[model samples]
Target: MPRLADKRRAILRGALTVFAREGYTRASIDQIAREAGVSTRTIYNHVADKSALFETVIQESAARVAEAQVEAMDRHLGGAVPDLREALVAFARDHARPTDADHFALVRQIQAEVGHIPEAALDSWQDTGPRRVQRAVEAHLARFMAEGRLRTADPHRAARHLVLLAAGEVTSRSFHGALPLPAKEVDAIVEDGVEVFLRAYAP
Candidate 1:
């Protein structure tokens, strides 16, 4: 059972790389098998088909991205910060950054293939990824509101506001992560975002 689980994980990792590079239409089981260092028959033993594999990959990758985002929120917002602005800037920086090179590649791949992929796959990704991140941010904002650190009538709205303020310009200027912004530039954007958020939500 352990060996089977390890092979499945290996196949998923390799599939991510191939799918990211070649995209859904071009990605082949044989290529994924080679990338995984497993036989094509072995891959077939794990997943029923390419579509199944792709869906699983999307879900797994989304979970990983969501985990990283939630962790960032907890790190910057869960605990006490001497300076809210500075802490928020740090959070924004982390939020904007990709979890890793492979994760970045998978994100780009998803964007590239979004129009081509199944609606179910897209929904799965959104449910596991962005929605989860939004919930985490909302929970953090609710905590701040309860503590009287922020004056928010609606914690959900405030969370959305903060996320948009922090991410909008950076995402646009970065071309949705296609272009990498330098650390200093990211910090500047986050600083401005935090200022705007404070103007709206601070007590």
Candidate 2:
């Protein structure tokens, strides 16, 4: 028999892959068990049920993604995201590498499944990944404008554009299964995007 710790780790990794690919509803404990090369009894020993296992995967992935995004922003700033284009580029490029697929895909599945489970969706959204960068960007822009680094008349308008710039490509890909994008090509896009953005908001 596998050690308790080994079995648990196996379950975790297996669940992550299944969630990211098959989604929450379709991802079964049996499938996860098969993927882990363990038995269903092993998964149940670690997590009470499929829902519990789903939450566990989401929480772990969200924490990692949030940490990386926060760290990228922190490196760009002493403590705050002050400039518009710089912050947009930082957010996009950092998150664009696509870490924590299980957590992200699980959150997406949970949100879609929430309508079917009234009481459970509340906890699901509260615990899972969120589209929080929009509000964070708005707050940062407002602060910089207040201090005069930027001269934007509408922080909201700026926030919309920033979100589009950061997430548009990845969002499109998620729907269409990743398009043809190489690393150098992506970098070129980001570079030109920054120039265009600066021109639109330059002082």
| TM, every model | 0.91, 0.69
Q: By TM-score, who's the top model here? A: 1
Alpha-carbon lDDT of model 2: 0.65
lDDT of 1: 0.84
lDDT of 2 at 26: 77
The window of 10 residues in a row where model 2 has the poorest summed lDDT is: 171-180
List ranges where model 1 is wrong by over 4 Å.
175-178
The lDDT for every candidate, in the order shown, is 0.84, 0.65
- Regions of model 2 farther than 4 Å from truth: 1-6, 79-88, 100-128, 131-139, 152-160, 174-177, 188-203
Residues 70-134 of candidate 2 have per-residue lDDT tens digits of 66655654365545566657666665555555566665665566664335534544544344444
